[model samples]
Target chain A: MKNLTLALAATIGFLHADPLPSWNKSDSKQSIISFVDKVTDAGSPDYVAPAHRIATFDNDGTLWSEQPMYFQAYYIFDRIKQLAPEHPEWKEKEPFASVLKGDLNSALAGGEKALLEMAMATHANITEDEFSKSVADWLATTKHPKTGIAYTDMVFQPMLELINYLRLNDFKVFIVSGGGIDFVRVFSESAYGIPPERVIGSSIKAKFEIRDGKPVVIKTPEIDLIDDKVGKPVGIHRYIGSRPIFAAGNSDGDYQMLQYTSAGEGPRFGLIVHHTDADREFAYDRDSHVGQLNKALDDSKTQNWTIVDMKKDWKIIYPEYIESTPSQ
Target chain B: MKNLTLALAATIGFLHADPLPSWNKSDSKQSIISFVDKVTDAGSPDYVAPAHRIATFDNDGTLWSEQPMYFQAYYIFDRIKQLAPEHPEWKEKEPFASVLKGDLNSALAGGEKALLEMAMATHANITEDEFSKSVADWLATTKHPKTGIAYTDMVFQPMLELINYLRLNDFKVFIVSGGGIDFVRVFSESAYGIPPERVIGSSIKAKFEIRDGKPVVIKTPEIDLIDDKVGKPVGIHRYIGSRPIFAAGNSDGDYQMLQYTSAGEGPRFGLIVHHTDADREFAYDRDSHVGQLNKALDDSKTQNWTIVDMKKDWKIIYPEYIESTPSQ
Candidate 1:
């Protein structure tokens, strides 16, 4: 009878313990567990096939930091500085001039209009292959301004474990963001273990042709697709064909994605990662400049979507400090 | 001296006998073995990461027979006849009139131009979900005209084995074809073990909106994308965002796919399935009305792509028959 009592206590302790030791079981962590459990429990009639199990995550804030300015915007700024000698005219351009002068705040002060101009100038005219190479090269050397770590390493450790866990269970995980597809494709494999092909994001218009006896596709300035908000569902339908059973996001931009995924028939899961830990991480939601998480919070309560309090659930923020070697 | 003589005689007898028991070891089979050896052997410099391994295959000829007409065309014809009662005007229309009168040859005599009309009439206006269900219903009952076997059973067995082998090796295989995405998505899983999300194909326009307090994306008649021939590479780039490392095709329409895949700066593999067994299956290429293989044949020689001789490499065509199943 004593042995049975001890065994039951041990089982209860294991069940309550963090299933993912790599993750810090904060509020964000709890939300992920609750959502995954509801969708993955076969006994509850919510079990999904390994094939139908798909989870799409927004990258910038949902997976990593997108503080004062977007991470891609910083990448674009650096790229402009590096390519300034090649295109002297950029020094005199409106947004480019501001960016070159080290005034990103003023450059993007005009909001979407200025951002579009900067994006178009930097991203256009190059072959898609060249753009991919450039992004890869930049990511290899560039470090985040605050963390002093490579931008790639700044990804949330808990989120990375969630991604791997979902994949282990046969879920086809994808990164769907408003960021350029080429930019994210570079380090997605090394950082998130999500292959380049599985990452679907924004894209520039491109044309396929044979040049110098070699086939090449060139990225043009014309906006082909913007994968955000309503565009998320459209892009998902266009690329993935089937509706995802699970979705995770940290901003209002992801509301539609969660809605589309949760509204589907059969088992479904939706989660919103609320950045509530200011000391360990940035904490801004309703009135934040980047990655606003207000509308989603209201929707979370009404729609019964799991809301993740980042500070409470996560025991650690990044994987690097957890072990001596970062790669593991 | 007598014992040595006996040993030499035994060695000679062993050499005279065929080494491979089940396989015929024809040129086509040898090519497959050589390619798989180079890619899979870790000792070889050509070894690739399972994650980076991507293989794309054309559908109509590579997977199944597209003889008298594309099997989907036959399905559309049957669909038109079945759905004709709802629309009395379809009986009076030119293409529909010819289709209803059982003069399929005359109706499709105009070729692609006539086929487009039939496709548009049969596939438009319904919600994407409704259209998918319709396709599923059709496939459940549809049988091939010649062998009286279900069309799904007509899928080539050896090719199916290749798909499974590639997947086992961590290759992310995709089906890039000109077929309607919805139609192919219906039966691709049961036939090829490829889920709907991995199948990238031609698409009609769709619009997303809230209907009856719920979000729904509706399909439209306007052709949005065509994934065939030159368009195959474009579709692959748009949907997958990564160049495939290996490609397989059976016709000229897949030429660009092979070209785009093989053109990547790495060890690449390209194979063309050449139909040469008229006794067991239909064997028309080059000048064939459907699934022309001329351009691919010409490029295969120029580009040094492997050509798979159906009669030589495959002991069995379809999976249903065990008598002709290849041993290895």
Candidate 2:
């Protein structure tokens, strides 16, 4: 009698275990389940072949915590400081000087031009191999300002589960982000289980040349492609050459990408991860400077896109880390 | 006694089934087989993991015949005439007018700039979807100038075998070509079993916008990345994000790509297809107007790269097509 009861309990447990444990049983979670089911179901009219089951995600806001500021922006700031000794002119320059002094507001005071100048100083004139190693080193050592945890640890627990679930259902997951491609690529394969080739993003130009009878890629400051807003769909068309069946984003930058994916033939899924947990994470959206989600939020309702209210929809905000402490 | 005789005959036939029937038994063929064996052998020190087994091929002259003129060049020339009715200026234009008059020599007199002008007119200023459809439609209807066979049928049989052989050994094959990415992608999967995502090449700028409340990609005339010579390595780095163990090409355009691949840390293989079979195919190399193979030909010997002599290394030049007729 005892053995039979144990077996019955085990079967029940297997049936009840949630694939996305961090995600609460809300309509947002329900929509995800329904879409995956419809696409994967052999009997369903919306069944898509595994080859065509492409799912793209906005990395910075959708996959991880882009709060405080974008994570890559933090890396770039550190790079500016590290590269200051070589570029003495940066000490007196407006943007680089501000960056060095830890005054971000003053640095970004000049807007996009200032950002590009800072980026060029730190991101270019180095071999690609060197740049990649620097990114890897920073990712290994850096901690999130608010979380007091490794930046990698700030990745949302729920998003990880969702990615795994999609992968299990034979969907080819791709990171189509506005972040620097090389920067995201260093950590993406290890952190998010997305390969380097599958990640697409903004990139600076790189020149290939033979130096001392050896091949080396020299990254130049010239902006190659800005893969945000209108550029996302173009990047998708250029790189993947196929329309994604599922798209996820958290900002207006992803508006066109979502629009492109949803407009494709047959059933498509669009999702937004709305920052609603002020206590655990952030609360601002439309007014926030980083990852502003204004037009996309309003469009979500009309488009029937699932909006995950992080406070109610996410049972947990981030992965547990050794140094993490709850805000009092 | 009869059964024993038959068994002996079958065993003899099995030993010489010829995996690459179009390739003659030569050092070039031996080098390819040896490299593949070394990389795939689990016990060998040079053994590469399946994920890292990337092999890139240059498409035009390497995989298929680019004789007389490039097959796509023919397509572009035909498009100029087809589109001439809409643009009255083309009737008197230098390159366009020369193209319409069937004066190939005068059309190419201005060189690369003239080619770019033609490409921008026919290859851009339309939706990517529409351009793809146009290429597909042309491929379906058009035949090669001399062969009377579909252009797709002109693919080199030995190269196809080599691609298949690499795939069988768990290598992921990619096409890194000077040709437009979209143009190669249309037939790559069907002809070579390499998907669109696996092909990287030159591109023109594109814009994403909402048309009639629907998102679409509009190709612009501006050049993006030119995937030739030095650009090949840059494209490979940007797309694959890893150095290929094996690289193959047929001209000076692929010199840097071969150099990049051969310079990697591990045991690398570089092979060049030298067109030498004048009887079976066009044999111009050093003095050829298209796919000029001058400097790289000298570099191949020093680098120890395999140079495949079409006359000596290949038993057949092209794959037999349904309507293929021997050139009289």
Candidate 3:
């Protein structure tokens, strides 16, 4: 009788327990659970090999917040300000002039042309080690404009839980993004449990050389590769070789990656996060200047890719007390 | 007295015992030994953290023979011949025409431009899976023109032992090659014990889509990314962001990779394989059209990189016939 009563209590506890407590049970949550259940249940004929269990996530909006402007862009802006004393000429430079004026809108008004100028000026002429240190220093102190939180702290806790859950099920997760390679690598391990090597992103040219009896590599202004849109699939093929079986994205920029991942043989999953709750978090998707999600939405129904409703799926947004405590 | 005799016998056996009996230690053998010893010995100051134990090898000359053109090109030539009847236009195509006419020199006369055309015609319009199968089928029957041995059989036994040795010491060994991604993926695992996903190489475009209620990806004629020369470091950064602590190469093309590997913080090893024995194997460098060693030789001296004198360290070149043959 004692054993039967203990077994009953255990069963009741298991039934009431939330599988993904860190994530609020929303439509996004349901989609994740349904997809994971479908793929993980061996008895249901959806079991996948550990080798084939590859999951790719977009870095910016999908994994963290990319509102107002990209967090890395802000990091670059702060970097320019910090280095301003050494290079007084940057005060008179066009984009740098606007940047110093605190008018990022006008500074980036020229789009790719202006952004390239800013990137070249800030990312070049330094040894990779120096660039890494500069980035680390900037990220350590930089805060998001609206939330008054550290840029790193703005990451969605639900996504963090999702990453952990996928990894627990033998999934090899990779960050495929358009962000700078070194920039993402700085915090990927601590924040996402993804080591620097597994993070694939845009890159600038680097030169090999020896300095002070030790070999060193210096970053060059020349753009080596752009890992975005069509480049995503190309990057995945070049770096990863095998197509991913699962992909998560929050914008149209990740469409190709999701397409490539879902197009592979056997069980596959493609998920798109829809930011529709303004009270809990900022809400803007289709027409958002940063991470536009329009084209992906149009194809979501046709492709049968899962659309995660942020408001319905998530019980919480960022981690508890994230607004008070910086992520770094 | 009996115990002393037993101890003497044990010492004699230890002195005579070959640790890697399956490997015919050649000139490149000693460098491999020195590298492994430095990196793997816990007592050595050169000991590296398991995470820092990243090693990369060039596929063609470093891992296997690339003489008479890269083996993958030979595989493509054979593929074109096998598929000749199905594609009538191939008969009149410039490179394909020369290839079909058995004029190897003329087919590759235009270098990468001509090679790209030949590759596109031969590889396009097939699903990625189908292309993999085609490569697997070709490798099974294809033999090296010089040795008349299976292409897989031409891999240096010493290098094979080195790969296993490094892997056993917790080193993450990766193949960063200039060969076609699909071409290398077919045999990398069976030949080198490297899974296809870990192989980074040049690639053509591929498309993902669902067909017949199942996901499938199709290879396209578009040139995606080429993994060669300076492109090697770019590929490495994009795929494996961590700077490798050890790099092995046989040509000037590998100079940048070696430089990049050795440029990382902490202990590193860079080795260049010098082909100097015409008796045991083909010997040509500096002026050689393929695998030029001139630039690398100068850089190796200037950068303090170790150069492997193949003639001195190796006891044998290829695996012994008896060793390679199947057990009775």
Candidate 4:
């Protein structure tokens, strides 16, 4: 009788368990739950087949903190430092010199052109395997500038739970990011439970060749797809070959993606992660240079997109680590 | 006693059932079974994880009949006839005029440039959904000129079983074709059980746009990736994000794909479908106008790729449709 009582209690606990434990009780959380329920329930009018249950998430600010500049920019800077000794001419090069001097503001003063130059210099010529290995190595040793935590660990706990929640409901989740594809693929599986094949992002052109009697795909110093803004929808059309029923983003960079997802036929869910928490995490939007959220935030109400107030909606910002305190 | 005896008989039959019933007892069939067994056996040294068991197949001649010109070429010609009323200028245009005149040789005399023009004319401007709808309609109404069968019905039965066999072994099957991605995606799922996301092929540039308050992906006239020959491996790298453990193809277009797959670490399988039966199917290889197989055929001996002789290996060339007989 005691064992039966314990078993019954355990069954009830399992049945009533919250999927998104980090998310507090709010409209933002309820919207997500209700959306999943409507789509997965066959008796509901908004029932979507398992094959059509594709959910896309923007990586930079939506899945993780993109503050203090994009994490990939830091990777490019680190790669420039690692490859600096070989390129003596880089000492006098404007962007390279500024990057080496540790003046990120001055280095980025040239804007997209300078960033593209640095990215190509470090990212191209090597085999795809080598490039991914370098990214994995840098991620293992490097720490975020402000948080002093591993970059992968800075992923939003609530968002992770949401991903798991949707996946549990038979949604095929994909990361449609503006970040480099190769760089994001290294940790996507370990961090987000998303695989490399499901990652669609910006990329450099690559060529296949036989080197030393072994096959290698060498990255070329040419831009391929820039999967940001309008390109996000194009990337989705080309890669996923279907419209996502659910989309999530944190900034205007994902404005078109949210627009496209919400425009799809049948029941659709669009989520905007508004960084409203200044105490728990860095909070800057609208006027902020990186991850500007003006247009998407303003249009969220008109678009029927759910706005996630980080400070209010989320109970925990980041996953708890062994060494760090909640205050950190 | 009867029930017990019948149950024992059914169990024995299930255990000894042949996975590839259409494939004759040949080295080609044995190689596939052995490779699958080696990779799936947990106690074997050559075992590969389920995630890494990716098997890619070329579409046109490898999976279906591509003898009387390419199948997509036929689709282009049909589309031109359907849209000829919109552009009266096409009636006098060189290639278009030849296509309208029913002179295929004259139309193709202008070579790749002429083919590209025809393809772009028929394929571009429409939304992706519209494009796929046209492909489906064409497949439904059109019949093969020589075989008098539906295009989807032209799929090789042996290859179909092989795909199913690999899928049963937990290998993810993908259609890596030289055909247009959109065109192949229309029938990939229904015909081969390969979904749109698993089909990687040649593509034209497309843009995401909003027209009349609806989101649409407009196909552009310009080319994106060709996904033929060397481009196959590049597509595999960019799309699949990893080298396939098993690769199958028919022509030289798949040479690099076979090479790349075989060169990967650990056990790998490469197969070449050689059409050698004039009575059963068209028989032309090294000197064929389409699907030239010279280079890959010669390299197969050194690469240790299994060669499937269509006539000798396959018990049936095509599936047993309601209207078709074994002689077909």
Query: Which structure among the candidates has the greatest DockQ?
Result: 4
The lowest-lDDT stretch of 10 consecutive residues in candidate 3 chain B is: B10-19
Q: Fnat of candidate 4, please? A: 0.67
Q: Which ten residues in a row have the lowest lDDT in candidate 4 chain B?
A: B6-15
Q: List residue ranges in candidate 1 displaced over 4 A.
A: A1-13, A22-31, A34-41, A322-328, B1-24, B322-328
Candidate 1 lDDT over A40-97, as tens digits, reads 6777677676778888998988888787678899888898898899989988877888
Q: How well does model 1 score by local distance difference test?
A: 0.80
Instruction: Report the lDDT tens digits of candidate 1 across residue range B1-328.
Output: 9967755553442333322223245665566555666777798898887776889988888988787789889988998998899979987887888889999988888788788778887887776777888988887887777777778888888888788867877789999988888789888999999988788888887666677787766777887778888888878887777789889998888988899888998788888988888977878888888888897898787787988888876766777573244422
Each model's backbone clash number: 8, 0, 12, 0
TM-score of each: 0.89, 0.91, 0.82, 0.94
Candidate 4: pairs in clash: none
Sorted on DockQ, best first, the list reads 4, 2, 1, 3
Best by TM-score: 4
User: What TM-score does structure 2 among the candidates reach?
Assistant: 0.91
Which scores better on DockQ, 1 or 3?
1
True contacts kept of each: 0.41, 0.80, 0.31, 0.67
Instruction: Give the DockQ-based CAPRI class for model 2.
Output: medium
Model 2, B252-317: lDDT tens per residue? 999999998998888899999998888877787889888999888999988878999989998677
Chain A TM-scores for all candidates read 0.90, 0.93, 0.90, 0.94
Better of 2 and 4 by lDDT: 4
- Candidate 3 residue B120 Cα shift, in angstroms, is 4.9
Per-residue lDDT of B180-250 in model 3, one digit per residue for the tens?
Answer: 87888889988899877678888777765555765456688988667787777766765666689888889
RMSD of each: 5.9, 3.8, 5.4, 3.7
